[model samples]
Target: MNIVLTVLEVTAPVFLLAAVGFIWVKMGFEYRVQFVTRLAMTLSVPCLIFVSLMQTDIAPQALTALSLASIAAYVLVTVLCFVLVLLAKLDRRTYLAPLIMGNTGNLGLPLALFAFGDVGLGYAVVVFAVMAIYSFTFGVWMVSGGGSVIKVVKEPMVGATVLGAIFLWQGWETPRFLTNTLDLIGQIAIPIMLITLGVAVARLHPGRLGRAVWLSVIKAGICAAAAWGVGIWFELDQIALAVLVLQVSTPVAVTSYLLAEKYGADADAVAGLVVISTLLSIITIPVLLIFLM
Candidate 1:
């Protein structure tokens, strides 16, 4: 009973902020998604990652372990999701990336912070960094069949991750004033991201929702199982293990739909996956937190 309340306390705010965005959109409010997303990714999120890594108390060894485990988990998930897409006779370009890349940023980061505090956020950032690098490079290549290494290099989030890792390893810190400033900017990331998620979902016109529902269920299962197995294999600590599982098992990201639309894949089909998976996460995430907590 206590655990249930704890989980609710952690999760309620996330969904509620998202609901705010959804409601705002429904009420015909002006929310510029492209501008907001660009601000978050280019500025706010990078500050968050940098400051989190610089201030984190988690040992470098533990973070390294989590990073490796995250990579292994994604690899396993990719293989399994690939097989699922092939066997289901789905379009690989439309279905594959969404299945492999979950919403590790907007949902996963905040959940980690709420559930496990700073240490959890530290661990979650490592996993997010791993996923982001993979998604920008390999995941993009899977969709566009083109050079994606440059995209990864060009991403501010990637630069921040690398810089943060360097600071963590070197025991470096920015000036206290600068640190506080970055922290202030970073604070807006979670709420803004959550609200943007709701706005994105509310605006998406999902097609083939029946197929989406089943695929989302399967994706949730595969991601959780894969992360669990890899965490155990890598011998991650309790918090790290839990964070990895949660991050890896988040709903399909809205970015997946954007990528599909950009690359001329089945945008509507990917939109279905995004909306259904995100809606399904409301149930799945709370259940997951109950176990993790």
Candidate 2:
């Protein structure tokens, strides 16, 4: 019973903030998605990642274990999701990325923060950074038939991850004023991400919802199973293990839909995934949290 309440407490703000964005769009408000996304990803999210990694108290050995573990986890997930897509006889380009890449940015960050506090957020960011690197590089190449190294290197988030990792490894710190400035910028990342999630969902036009429903269920199950097995195999600590499971099992990200749309690969199908997977998370996340907490 207490676990249930704790799960609700941890999970509610994530959904509620997104609900606000959803409602805002429904009430005919104008939200500039591209602008907001650019702001968050370029400025706020980078600062958040850099500062979080630089300041995290997690031991270097543990952090190193997690970094490697996260890479292995995603690689395994990609194989599992790829096989699932093939068996389902779906279009590989459209289905594979969504299946493998979850909403670690928008939903995963806040959930980690709320469920396990700052330390969880630190671990969550590591996983998120690993996923982001894979998503921007390999995920894009899979979807677009070609991805550029130059383009991937130019991404602010990618730069931040590399810089932050360096700082963390070297025990370096920015000047006090600079660190505080970055911290303030980083704080806005969570709320903006959550709200953007809701807005994206509200505005999505989903198709093939019947297929989406079943596929979403399958995704949740496969992701949870895979992440759990991987975390155990890695022998991560309690918080790190929980964060791994939680981040890996998040719903399909809205970015998947945008990528599909941009690449001309059945945007509606991806939108169905974003909608269905996210709705499914409302149930799956709370249940997962109940167990994790």
Candidate 3:
């Protein structure tokens, strides 16, 4: 009961407020939600990355662990995508991105901060940075059927990661004023992401719920299992391993749908997968915490 309450306390407010915002959209305030999401993606999120990386202490060992974990995650997801395609007899384009790109940014980051605090958040940032690069580069390649790799390299998020990496590598100490400014912007990221998720959910089709549910279960289960087994074998620290497993268990990222829509890869299916995985995460995440924490 205490665990349940804790989980609800941490998770519910964000989603509930978003739900209210969704209802407001039903009453004709949709633009507000869009504006917030755009602000977060374009401004707040980059600041969050800059602030977090600039402040966190990055030892060589920690960097090594994070690098290994990131590679593990990428390899696991790639193999899973292949198996899923073969086993489910899915077309290459249908489930590729949605299957590989879990929701590591919006949902995973917040949950890592909540569960493991600063250390978890730092580790998540490392993982997220690597995953972001892979998703933008290799993911686009796969989805675009070997289209211009140069175009993928030029994505704004790719540039953001590169900029953040330079800051991290230099071990730049952000001035107090700058850190404070970035922190203020960073604080808006979580709420904006949640509200965006809620608004997206509000547009979901009830008729597609069954398929969404199945995809969510598969995504959460397989991802968690892969993370757990690999993490244990790799001897990752408790908190790092926990963060990795929880991140992997998250639903398909919202970006999956965007990419699918852009690349013509079953956008509806990707959207449904995102919604389903996110909703089901309310259950899977807590259970995962029980094991990981």
Candidate 4:
């Protein structure tokens, strides 16, 4: 009973903020998604990652282990999702990326902070960075039928991750004033992301919801199972392991739908995935937190 309350306490704000965005959009408010997304991803999120990594007390070795573990977990998820997509006879271009990637940035980060505190956020950022790079490069290519490594290199988050890792490695800190400024900017990231998620969902027109439902269930199972197995194999500690599983198993990201729309690969189908998987996470996330906690 205590655990249930704790889980709800942690999750309620995250989902509620998203709901606020949803309601706002439905009510016909002006919410600029492109601006907000760019601000969060390019500026706020990178600041959050940099500050968290710089401030984390997790041992350097542990951070390294978590990074490797995250890479392994994603690789495993890719393989499993690929096989599942093939078996289900889903269009590889549309279905494959959504199945493999997740809403790690928006949902996973905040959940980690609330569930496991600062240490979990530190670990969560690593997984987010890995996923960002992978998604920008290979995942984009998969959807558009072409990808560029240079695009990955130019991403702000990538630079932030690399810089953060270096700072962590060297046990370095910026000036206190500068650090505080970055922290302040970083603070808005979670709420912005959550609200943005709600807005996107509110705006999306889902297609093939029946298929989306079943596939979402399958995605939850396979993602959790694969991430768990990989975490155990890598021998990550409790927080790292749990963070990896939660991040990997998050709902299909809205970005996947946008990509499909841009690349001409069944946008409505991807929207179905985004909506259904996110709805499914409302239940699945709390269940996982109960266990993780």
- Candidate 3 lDDT over 17-63, as tens digits, reads 55865686677674555577668767887777767766667564765
Over 29-71, each residue of candidate 4 has an lDDT whose tens digit, in order, gives 9999999999998999999999999999999899889888888
RMSD of each: 0.8, 0.9, 2.5, 0.6
Predicted structure 4, TM vs. truth: 0.99
Report lDDT (Cα) of residue 80, candidate 2: 88
lDDT of 1 by residue, 48-130 (tens): 99999999998999998898899899999999999999999999999999999999999999999999999999999999999
Candidates 1 and 3: which is better by lDDT?
1
> How do the residues 1-293 of candidate 2 rate in per-residue lDDT, one tens digit apiece?
88898999998899999999999999999999999999999999999999998998888788888989899889888998899988989999899999999999999999999999888988999999888888888989889998677877898988998898889889999999999999999999999999999999999999999999999999999888888888899899999999999999999999999999999898998999999999989999999987887
Q: Please, what is the whole-model Cα lDDT of each candidate in the order they appear? A: 0.94, 0.92, 0.74, 0.95
Between candidates 3 and 4, name the one with more favorable TM-score: 4
RMSD of 3: 2.5
Q: Candidate 4: where is the Cα deviation over 4 Å? A: none
Q: What is the TM-score of candidate 3?
A: 0.88
Ranking by lDDT: 4, 1, 2, 3
Better-scoring candidate (lDDT), 1 or 2 = 1
Any idea how many clashes model 3 has? 0
- In model 2, the clashing pairs are none
> Model 1, clash count?
0
